[model samples]
Target chain A: MTTFQELRLDGVRRRFGGKDALTGLSLTIRRGEFIALLGPSGCGKSTALNCLAGLLPLTDGSIWQDGSRLDTLPPERRGFGMVFQSYALFPHLSVRKNISFGLQMRRLPRDEVRRRTDEAIKLVRLEEHARKLPGQLSGGQQQRVAIARAVVLEPSLVLMDEPLSNLDAKLRLEMRTEIRRLHQSLGLTTVYVTHDQEEALSLADRLVVLRDGRVEQIGTPEELHNRPANAHVADFMGYRNLLPMKVKAVHGDTVALDGSGLTLEGTPVGPVAPGDDVVAGIRPEDLRAGPHGVPVTVEVVEYQGRELAIEARTAEGVALFLRATERPSPGDRITVTADPSRVLVFP
Target chain B: MTATLPDRDTSSTRVARRHRLAERGIDRQLLLLAPALICVLALFVYPFAYGIGLSFQPAEGGVFGAYRAFFTDAYQRDTIATTLGLALPAAILNVAASVPIAYRMRGRFRGKRVLTTILVVPITLGTVLTAEGLLNYLGPTGWFNRTLMTIGLTDEPVRLTNNYWGVFFSLVITGFPFAFLLILSYLSGIDPTLDRAAATLGAGWWQRFHRITLPLLAPGLATTFCLTFVLAFSVFPSAVLVGDPAGTTRVISIAAYHAAYEVYDYPLGSAIAVIMGLVELAVVAVVLGLRSLLYTGSTGGKG
Candidate 1:
């Protein structure tokens, strides 16, 4: 077993012309940790990775690997492995040669090179197509070859940028499982970047969600999914129901909200002034259909295999979605209830 | 009953007429190729066939007798050897001179367009004017020698005009731009991304050029070689003007011109021209066939 090593970025900033790509972003990656940098497109996730890989010059920052300064090192000298979003495999080389390229660069002994190539090809289960070029392989197979090439060098930290985006749906799921297994087995510090929430939640030990070149939230998947830091994080993590509520009164642990006859419960996660307008968010699954629920008219009913997505509008014209088994069709009046603890209040 | 049976036979005859109409449509399509075929026959094929026939025409004054006599002569044999000697060196020098200059000019800098224009001016002047300029500049009592003598670099004027070097200089000045343009385009056409990739993969500048750039440029180099060689081999005016037509610079094209224009032996001239064309075709074929080894088989499709 190998000991875990740490990677840290100190004030990393990247700028193109006048626009900032990564603005003073800094994070620490633990040894043997699988961290997912999750965000929407153009959220500076890829730019951060490129900066970490030393592919781009940082406008201001320093990168330290196990306490060694790495900001000035060239990409090949940085001692980090990167699998690109497109899996930028050297098209001219065969799968086996691609895996052996770094080793050859190191000028290793011939016998060791052959041994490592075989081991890498076996790890990716690409022995059968070892002699074939990447173009001849399927997208998933090319991804495996890319992973194999990155892993063959056995660098301390591995950075993957949307490696599974090119794969088909079924193959993506399969490779997701494979990647998780490899991460567990290899115990390498990894930073995986993706725009897909499910990909981040399913594969990451901890998630770092970014927005507008800033870190929105950083936590475990459960922490992000359950207690999002803000409305943006909640909306990004699949919280579709956001309603404006006026706080009527605050008493001890409970707060009364306006425009509703019933009192709403929340964790008071953010600062909220009494009688002030605020936003309350709840996951669709947290709301239920019951007799004492809030009155709303159903706009649409969508059956999504295991559950139903009910689009409903309140008497005050507030739109919301509630997940439940029994969904009311369009034009049907329904009442939706939410457990007060499941609701999130933000100012 | 008799009228109904006759109607059925009439319908079958109409079907046969339609089939004939379809056949005529196909005939017109085939006929559309006739004009192109006739042009190729009259313009290209007829001249080539006539040249071969004239080269092989029998004895006395015509046929292969002139070719046989020409080849059998010692002076003609020496001329062919001398032409090859000058042409090959000039071609090689022309290609060599272009590679570095074009390589340097591949990237943009101040005065690049001006330099390229100045370099291309000699090509626009063609071989004859270039040869005249070379004669004026390189003559024994020309500006070059006079300056050197004035500068005390040489006590006597150097013999630069009416020699093999004068013809070679003319060829280089005129042919360099063609080779340079061909190679500059070739070098620029290679995706710069490939260089970046190589660099990211731990390849240094020279290694990237050698391993990636050189292999990709093999086809361009081969083409440049053949084109420059053909141009140099066909040196006629320069060989007659700036060169020693009696001694050193009597090339094969000069031999053909002498046969056709001076001696008024059109058959001999045609035979020599046919030989030159055949030699060029053979060289080009060899060059192309050899380049197959370095070709990575068209980087576009999945190999």
Candidate 2:
């Protein structure tokens, strides 16, 4: 039986043909924790996950599981379950055989293999389709078989690389909950990699946002969404409006943006003094029409059922978007404001 | 029904128009295919029909006379076994040898293209030339044996050419590349992710091969064997040049050749040709029937 309390990645780096795919990635995964490596394409999130699974060799540094070196082991010896973006289920094998693959590989007793495989099938709710080939099953069913195939081995950690990316929107939502439930019920530590921030935010206990092969920030979904480390994270976190502003004054936690017809207040993130240039980030949901605020002309309004997503331009010709219940026509002047906490001022 | 006269008229005209369009399309396609169809009829079908007819109308006792006489005579009947003994081993060895080499070379590596190109050079140089080249290099007292004796690996020159072993070696040299190419194409069709998935599931290289790669490739291997067998079964030029045609390596094709060309016994030769085809067909059918027992799963290239 394999068990581990924690897995440590000490400055793990992967180089591909002289180009660094992952650079100095350091992370500690505690037992039963679901960590997400979230990034756009080519940001090394997949590389980090592959490194953990021992799929890709590390060009620099090492991975340790409970004080023993794990990097030296082959992928088969690592004893980690990895669900590829493609699922990678064997096309030739039946669902039951695919699930029992690891057990058979370990040379386990036949009855024990059958018992574990059946239990895994039950866990994934695929008992009816266990005899079917992967090609014979639906896409959602195939995804479940892939999950069942990996989790049947009872690996200490499960790595999922965009497992739901191929599914339709409804199926994706359903599998998201299913994956979380499995992780919790099985007590399996998970490291999920996805470019979708919403998936990472909802599924992971903590999100590690990577950029250009480096870890940009690592925090909980709420923390990263509300309090981003920089402009890049802020943009990714759905703070759609990032207006360049000059800091007129810094009073306590809030800094006032210079020359708004009505003075706009935003909380400062990095160090700032008088007359310093900074970006003011405002989430579309946070910016609301108030009695007194920055005056702008409504340019385009997209009716989104309950709320109207209004696109407006400020007096200085800077474009901004905000949601409002009030229906506004084009060329109508409106005032929008955010609370000091909602408005993030980044240097 | 008479009240809906215009609607029925329009529907009937539409059906007629559709039929006319289909007929026109088919006619044009048939016209374009005339040349190739004529070539096949003249070259393949006509000769095949003629041979079957000539084989039956033997200058002998009855309609079954040629077949009966060929089977009754020990010398003529033994040729089938001789042919199978040579062809089966050559085909099996070629395909078996190519499997590991093709599997290993499936992935890209330095000098891979150069090596494959060099290996396939024998195929481009046809069977007779390859046999001639083997006769030069691998014959008794040839440079190969000279080197072996000089190095004291063997005292006497190894007898390779002018025997059954010579023809077998020539067949392998000429036929290996054909089998390798076919096997390589089959191996390439399998998704690489399946291998990775197997590895992650705790399968070592050998386990992964026998269980995963071999099963997926079984159907393709069966096909490669049948094609290679057919080619080797009809061994003619190489058996004469590198093998003892009248002695140990008296293949069926050599007997058929002597009957048809040398002795002017066309009916006997035609009967032998038909028998040769029947034997090949029997082997192929047996192989295909056995191949069905393997897991002939889709390679999932679409996925």
Candidate 3:
């Protein structure tokens, strides 16, 4: 096990032209942890990954990997494996040659190279295509070959940049499970970057969500999904039902909200003074159909196989999506409620 | 609603239309090739068949007399040896000199545009002008001789112009740009990702170039060599302008021209031209065989 001393970023700054891509951002990554840098496009998640991989030079920062300074090292010298989004396979080489390339570079013996090449091919389940060129394989197969090539070196940290975005849905699911299993088997530290929230939720052991080139929040998947620190985190993690409210009264274990006629029973997320404007965040799946639900006019009802997602507009003109068993048609007057414990109040 | 297929009569008419369309496409293709096909048939095929016929027949009359003289004389056999000797080495030298310049120019820099222009500018200069430039620069009593004299390196001018070396130099200079451009484009067209992947796999620059770049560029090199070889083998203008006519640069084409124009013997000239074509075909076949050995499984000459 490698001990990571905070993987500190001391005022990391990157700029392109006048706009700051990574603006003096600071974050720490624990060793052996699979951290997904989650953000929208152009939020500098990829820029941050490139800096960590030593593929991009930082304008001003110090990055130390396992107590050794990494700023001076080039990508090849960094001793970390990188899997690009494009897979970047050698088109001229057969699958076996591609996997054995790194070992050959080490000037290993012929027998050893052959053994490791077989092992890497087996790891990706591409033994049958060992003699075929990369161009002959499908996109998913090519990506697996890329992973096999990266892992054959046994680097301590593996960096992946939206590696599954190119794959079809079914293949994406298969690769996600495969990547998680491979990560566990090897016990290698991984930094994955993706804009897809479900991908981050399903694959990452911890999520480092970024916004405008700064760390918005960092926690386990459960912490960020259930109790987001702010509006942006909540919205990013699929909290589509956000309503504005004022803190009318605050007491232990329960808070009274003004306007929209709602009282949420939960501990305040952070320090919230009285009369502070706050937004109540709730996942659509948490709301239910009940007698004491807020009166709303159903606008559209979409059946998503297992659950019915109903969009309703309240009398106050605020729209909210309620997931329920009972399907309501458009223009139907209804009431939707949620367990107060699941509601998140953020200022 | 009842499911129905298209009417059979309509479908049959559509199929007939498609058949007619395909026939029209074939006709169009034939039409597109007609001009080149007719030219090759008239000028190339007829002449080649006639040469074979003429070469086999016994020399009886004036034009056939030269053919009879060529086969029976040992002195005429020496021309074949001299032609191959000069052409093969000159072709090899041209190809060898183009590789490094092309490799260096693969990447971009400030003076890259200027350097490329300078390199390609030589191609536009005709063989006559190049020979003239060689005469001015490399001739005895020219700048080269004056420089050697001023440096106190030589007591007299050195002989370079009006020689085989002058012809070879002119060939290399004029032939190099064509080969270089071919090679440079091929080198640059190699997906750079291959090298990046190699680097990530722990291979250094030399290893990557050796294992990947050179092997992939082999087909391109073959094509460039074939083109330059044909050009060198058929050399006539530069040989006449810059080279010694006294048995030095009497390449096959020059011999054919001399027989036809100066010696006023058309049948002998045609015979020599036929021999030159045969020699060229043989050389090209050998070069292609060598190319196949280097790039064993590739399709030839994609460009």
Candidate 4:
């Protein structure tokens, strides 16, 4: 039996012909840790996941699973259970058969295989639909079967590649909770890949944000969300208000910025100096309607269930979007402000 | 009643009547099938009906004379078994060889189109050309024997041509490309991720193929088998040129041809042709029946 300890990816690189899909990814995953590889499409998150599963050979570098070199092994030898975005359940097989596939592949005893598959089906709450084929089941049920298939193998590491992407929005949310519960209860070292930032933030113990086939940043959800490494990351992490400004003054931790419609005091992230051209980023929620701020005419207002998302233009026609508890209509004049700590200045 | 009704209602009824006429106009879309329907009627149905009529009017004895003669004569009856022996093995071999080959070529790769084009060259060569090529190539003093001698595997030239094997080989060469193309398309329809998923689940390559790929591909294989069998069962040119036609390789089609043209027994030939067709249909039906027994589930995408 393989003990749960650490899976080390040391300089994982994958090159397709002349083009590099995954340049080099090196990360250590502790046992029971949920790691989310967050990136936009074509950022090599899937490629990295495939490499970890040994589905794709690395152009360079090595992987170690609990001190044993893993890169040289075939995918079957890697013993990783993966849930695909398309589910990829053998359409010819029934739900029970699909769930029991991995166990049967391992040549497990008949009774044990049956018991484990039954338990997994129950765990996914798909016992009623066990006899039906994947095509006969709804999208949610198929997803549950896929999850059951992967986890039934009882592999220390589970690799999920945008598993919820094919589900409807409501089903996606439901399955997200189901996945999180599965991860916590089973204590699986899960490496999930997704383009959705919110999904990565919600489920991951640590998040690795990638861009252009490279890791932009890797930290806990709060760390990456609060202290983004650069402007690209800040923008991706829902810092929607990225306004250009000239740095008026720099003191200790705060830098003052002067813009046509937005005069803001922001925390310095990287190097900043007086008179330097910088971009100040503020999240929609961070910007609120208050006094002693830039007067802007609201252009669009969106109702976001409990709050209003207001898009406005400044006196000089710079666009600003802010979220407020108070209702504001379009074409209304309002002043918005940002706390110094909430504002991030990127040069 | 019409006079009491409004003018609007009367005009609307007239329009509705015209719409109903259009809808009932012999299903306008079926007119598009005119060329295909005509071809089937003229080429297949008329010829088949004429053969059936000719078969019933026996040249001697009674109306069932030709069929009775075929069943009573051991020589004629043996042709059915001979044709089955030749066609069944040839079709089975063709499908068996192509399945693995097509599976390997299913995925996209460099020069795939070129490879497929080269592989299908034997298909266009036809039975006549292929038989002649095999005669020259597999003859006693041919390069194949020369190579065998040079390799020192055998001192005597191996007898490959001028026998049942010659015709079998010809059928394989000619029919393999057709089977390969069909099976390749079927293999391509199956999702590659299914195999990958199986692999990650601890299945080895052979296990994945045995358990997953083969089961999903069974129906397609059955179809390829039926088509290949039809191609092989009607063995005329190859049997004459390559096989020992009068003795060991005397297939049913040769019996039909011999009876019709050589002996001037058209009714007997018609009866033989009918029997041949029935036998082929029976084989195809059996294969289809076996296919039904397999898991013929949908291999759709994104599920």
Best by DockQ: 4
What is residue B301's positional error in candidate 3, in angstroms?
18
What lDDT score belongs to each candidate, Candidate 1 first? 0.81, 0.91, 0.80, 0.91
- Winning candidate number (TM-score): 4
Give the higher-lDDT candidate: 2 or 3. 2
**Runs in model 1 with CA error above 4 Å?**
A1-4, A241-269, A274-281, A287-302, A310-322, B1-42, B58-201, B216-251, B298-303
Model 4 RMSD in angstroms: 2.1
DockQ of each: 0.25, 0.70, 0.28, 0.84
**lDDT for each residue of candidate 3 in A1-347, tens digit (9 for 90 to 100):** 22354466667777766787886767667667788999999999998888877766888878876577877776666667778888877766788987888888887899988898899899999989999988789999999998999888887678898999999999999999999999999877789999999999999999989888888888999999888889899999998878888887788766766555444444467777679888888889987767885778889899999999988887877888888788878998887777767777787
Model 1, A1-62: lDDT tens digits are 22336788888888887998888778888888899999999999998988887778899989
**Candidate 4's residue-wise lDDT over A1-347, tens digit each?**
45458888888888887888887788999999999999899999999999988889999989998879999999999889999988899999999999998898888899999999999999999878889989899988988898899999888899999999998999999999989999999978899999999999999999998888888899999998999988888888999988889999988899888986667899988898899999888899999998768789989888999999999999889888898788878888988888999998888
Top-down TM-score ranking = 4, 2, 3, 1
Model 4, B156-192: lDDT tens digits are: 9999888999999999999999999999989988999
Q: For every candidate, what is the interface RMSD in angstroms?
A: 3.2, 1.1, 4.3, 0.9
Question: Candidate 3: where are CA atoms >4 Å away?
Answer: A1-30, A51-58, A210-216, A227-233, A241-282, A287-300, A310-322, A331-347, B1-115, B141-145, B148-159, B293-303
Tens digits of per-residue lDDT for model 1, B84-200: 787788888877788778867877688988898888888788777888788889998889999999999999998887989888888888888888888888878665544544444
All candidates: TM-score: 0.80, 0.94, 0.81, 0.96
Which is better, 3 or 4, measured by TM-score? Answer: 4
Residue A68 lDDT, candidate 4, scale 0-100: 92
* Cα error of candidate 4 at position B259, Å: 1.4
- lDDT of candidate 2 over B17-73, digit per residue (tens): 878988778445668888999999999999998988888887876898888889999
Best-first order by lDDT: 4, 2, 1, 3
Model 1: DockQ score? 0.25
Candidate chain B TM-scores, in order: 0.83, 0.92, 0.83, 0.91
